[model samples]
Target: MTHPFGFNYGGKTHYFVFDSESGSLHNVDYVTFLCVKNRLSIPFEGGEAEDFRALEKEEIDEINAELDQLASQGVLDSPCTVTQKKKRTGEIKALCLHICHDCNLRCRYCFADEGTYRTADKAHMPVEVGLRAVDFLIANSGKRKSLEIDFFGGEPLMNMTTVKAVVEYARSLEASTGKTFSFTMTTNCLLLNEENRKWLNDNMYNVVLSIDGRREIHNAVRKTPSGADAFDVILNNALEFRKIRGDKSYYVRGTFTAKNLDFCNDVLYLNDCGFDQISMEPVVTDLPDLQIKKEHLPVIFKEYEKLAAAYIDRRKNKDTWFNFFHFMYDLEGGPCVVKRLTGCGSGCEYLAVTPRGDIYPCHQFAERKPYKMGNVLQGVSYDRNVSDVFAGNIVTNKPDCTDCPAKYYCSGGCVANNLNFAGDMNKPYDISCAMMRKRFELSLAIAAIEACEG
Candidate 1:
């Protein structure tokens, strides 16, 4: 099933466009490639590729010209040497700043507590450090153009001083660089109060509160330092904040553990609470959480499907839309990018700054010392081991996924997760593959039903 150029497509082939000059391979799906193919041809000039439709003659010519350029550089054979190049729109134009390492609540699933998680000696980042990070971002903003900075935490508000500094700094940077800047925070919401809410409102900051659904489910997993229920205060603050914002963009992030598999009621409950967006992520850790056993996963998947289907139907029928995941799923042309492909911009394009000034690929990879891409002070440096691990698993092919039909879509799964748990990043991402296949199939089914009805 090899395409004319050298792209061998079987079930396992996750399509990627390799820039031989940059040594970077981009993960693009086949559908997107087909769309790209229909849009472009060679021998054209002067216009952004993005503005041109795939079916337009001039756009087609421009695409062919780009392909010819690649071919001249020995990257492709001719204008039609490879499948259509994936469009890198950079839609998720945001950066997550791990501003604080000290958290007030201690969840058992806290990746920070994971033995692999590393931090700088200090638990807080100074205002100057944040300013420098903003500087770095502003300098690189030309490449990305529009970008947003997100304040992430052990509890970001724990050091409100730094948060304020970074926000102000980003604004100043934007003023000087002419780059648009926005702010968001992912927090436990335990420390939020009227004063903080006012500050957030003044700054137009979006807040994503971490709450695990209802009282019992939330209290069971999230707790205060004194082991008391933390939801009461969080809910109160969220209500207060909502009153101030008068918008539905504020979100509640719910994490699902094995224990809460039977918690579909919580989804309805969140909707009743006037929340428009709700995020659900499975509890993933270095060591497999027993709650996410093979048998339990199907149940979890079924629960997600039930909740998502109901939520979508409600939204379509002019019922209240309560689910954030559904909105994210529908907005993107397909399923969530993370759920579909291997490797993200986490390391290469995106870097996470810890409170102590150390940088890692992401929060999850921060815990793993080997995955630390570099430090802020020293600048960006790619570790060969890290690159090799990623290249072997994601950038290159593997024996298990080499011949599989779904390889292109899954991209052999998460390199960091597979490397950490299975001691091999090159192995097949069987778990994620199964999950994505179900999601893709479900989405297609829903689309078909809608088409028939219309």
Candidate 2:
């Protein structure tokens, strides 16, 4: 009973359960649901045993089948070989380089706190630092034949020269080192033009174009330092970039703040604009205006429903698709088989290097000492105590997550998010937890539908 969790939906309260123990998802009718509920409420001793014997044979058989399945899934405290949590067995597989600490656009809901993290003057990462970051990733990638390098920043495109230099140097190392490199760049599209498009098309593995959906939505929050609108420029660059990017190695990444609760149209808007791969995420912040409010949850849910329908419509039409969270789910397990109890590769397999070569656990923790791992030049020589603390942050260490059915799938929530909202890395973000629950419910339903159809 501990692992099989689900929700009732549609008319007459049809019940669906996700059996996490065996990774099985199935539905139970009203009578079966009631029988299971009643039996769990009472101990099967003297009184409960008599009550159970009074039930009809068919009902008892149905209830017994449910119990057997639940027992098989280890829900009834049945003894079984517990799946142990895994540590990183591989080397550094991915690294995010904060190529610049300054951005040209003045996006209102920027989690980077308007580029400088609201602390100091803006600066760009020099070529030397970027090159060292590339080297650091290569050197520390141990035994892993392939590595992913992400060029992140206040605006990665602002330091085009540094990006080009790093890519070229990385490519130069590939032949001799015999390591395959997958390069990605995240940009606001404010700086994209003919030359930049050509360079990205030629060298980059993929470009994440940051545009907040429709023209009005994009202009409302995402703007230039001079208060100029970003919609026109972003659209223009995306069109040109897409022309050379016929293979579709790019994703239109957007953000939806509290203001844009009904943002489903934005996905359709991007689709109409000829962009297929799209990701629209709710803005993660505690700021009043930007944060997703409780009232906005329903609207967001509806929006996701609409987006899912649109995705199905696209598939039917033999057209492109807007890849969203539900699109990532399969009956086998949402995305991938997560061996570790943790949700992400923050401090273990991935490292985030700041402009000055300051190393952090991940991109969100960049410039923050609390999550600092090591500098690029010095390598990821983490402090013993800090390393131990992060190592213990898996689901087994988190009391709340230990009982959660979605623990294996949710990346145990983001460390940076926890530290930001609750002032502690071990603390959880309750808001995001609700969001994850809704997402899991939707994903489970999609998985059920697909399973039935197939």
Candidate 3:
């Protein structure tokens, strides 16, 4: 069976097939096109093809009229029956390997605890498992041009042996297959030392550390296993690691809990610490915490708006670097591709492999067994149900959002957040709704200023 692929171009669906040998194209049905590549076999409903050689002029006009009707109903792109070659689907661009399931620090807010982590075998993935994962990625290099292996964990560095083994194995695979492998790790940064720093720097590994903000705010929540100050050690190591790596690509990921919402200014203080890229993510919640009360929405949004505004002002003075808001500021007028609008490439373009070789949709869903799509042992397969769950289909088609001006920008909020808070991955909550509104308003305001200046 020929695999089918389709994309929206010039406001119409253009279909093609994967010519594995010659990189040539073939025409096929939209469903067949997607099915051949083991993707969702859905067909586009509207739009006219540039050429209608297969049908009479009257038939072509009829199809074009149907396309026009669908376009009127807000569906503009219709699939075309065309023979064209495109990229294969088996290519592995990103491999998120779960090296360890055991984290040292028990933060007040962690999603892993909501699910059973004890029943999971191999608390830390053995070197052999990592090798197998890397091997699968290497074997599928034809579809992928470049490969990236991200080290994730309860705390990944907790099992440094597996990290080293995977890195070495990936390097070996690269050498033999003539494929490129890039490595990155997300850690609490407590395990970083001179030896590890030197190794990571030498290997050009990208590192992301979890830091809430300044000392008082950071330590108040992000405590060490011993219940002591985790801030000093983590901060000190991050500072030293930047010096050792001699690059600004290293990132600091801050998780905003209700306790630290008032301390947005402390988040900006990282500028004084010499860190460049910083990511601010709201606390992942299954339900509203006492701190994230409904009354707090206005306060939180105002605080976030203030912080974002101040960060933009600082960038004007070239005094500090704030990555989250900076990105929004930068993308003011550019034509946004659909994939880019999704913000994250989670289930659509990426998957996460657990320590035990269990495959889930993405890192956020790794802890939930019900969300586990497949495993590495038997190879991975696509799951339409899982895809729909992640696509925000649960909350997206809601009546409330249908008329919202910022619907496109909000993307119906995060699936994980909805699932966690409402106990249904498809439900929308007040927090995300409010946050989305605030963010959209701020983004539009910024865009307006840019337009006026231009």
Number of the top candidate by lDDT? 2
Per-residue CA lDDT of model 2 for 1-454, tens digit only, reads 1333333333233456555544556676644544655655633443545565577888778777867877765655344233555445335778888888899888888889777755586778888888888787777788888889899888998888888898889889999998999899999887899999988888888889988889999999988889988799889898889878987588888898987887888878888888877888788977798898777787887777666556655744536655664356765535555444545777777778888888777888777777666676676354445545666666655667655657666756888888777677777787777777677766776556546643
Off by over 4 Å in 1: 1-94, 114-122, 140-142, 202-206, 286-290, 316-319, 326-343, 378-413, 426-429, 447-454
Q: What would the per-residue lDDT of candidate 3 be over residues 48-67, giving only the tens digit for each residue? A: 22222234657545545644
TM-score, every prediction: 0.70, 0.86, 0.71
Q: Rank the candidates by TM-score, best first.
A: 2, 3, 1
lDDT of each: 0.59, 0.73, 0.62
Q: Which tens-of-lDDT digit does each residue in 1-454 have in candidate 1?
A: 1121112212232333433222223344543344333433432234323544435666556656765665566654322222212213222345567777777886777767621144555367688777766765565444666777778878887889988988877777665667877788887888888888888778845778788788888888677778888888988888777777766357778877777786566777777787777776666553455246667767867776676566556656444765455234231254444333334545534556766566666666664666765555554343535434343344234667543333444456666666655677666445555655555444433443344333
> What's the C-alpha lDDT at position 12 in model 1?
37
Name the regions of candidate 2 deviating beyond 4 angstroms. 1-15, 27-57, 60-63, 66-70, 73-86, 332-342, 378-385
True lDDT of residue 210, candidate 3:
81
Candidate number with the higher lDDT (1 or 3): 3
In the order shown, what is each candidate's alpha-carbon RMSD?
12.3, 4.7, 13.6
Model 2: pairs clashing at backbone N, Cα or C within 3 Å: 1-75, 343-411
Winner by lDDT between candidate 3 and candidate 2: 2
Give me the candidate number with maximum TM-score: 2
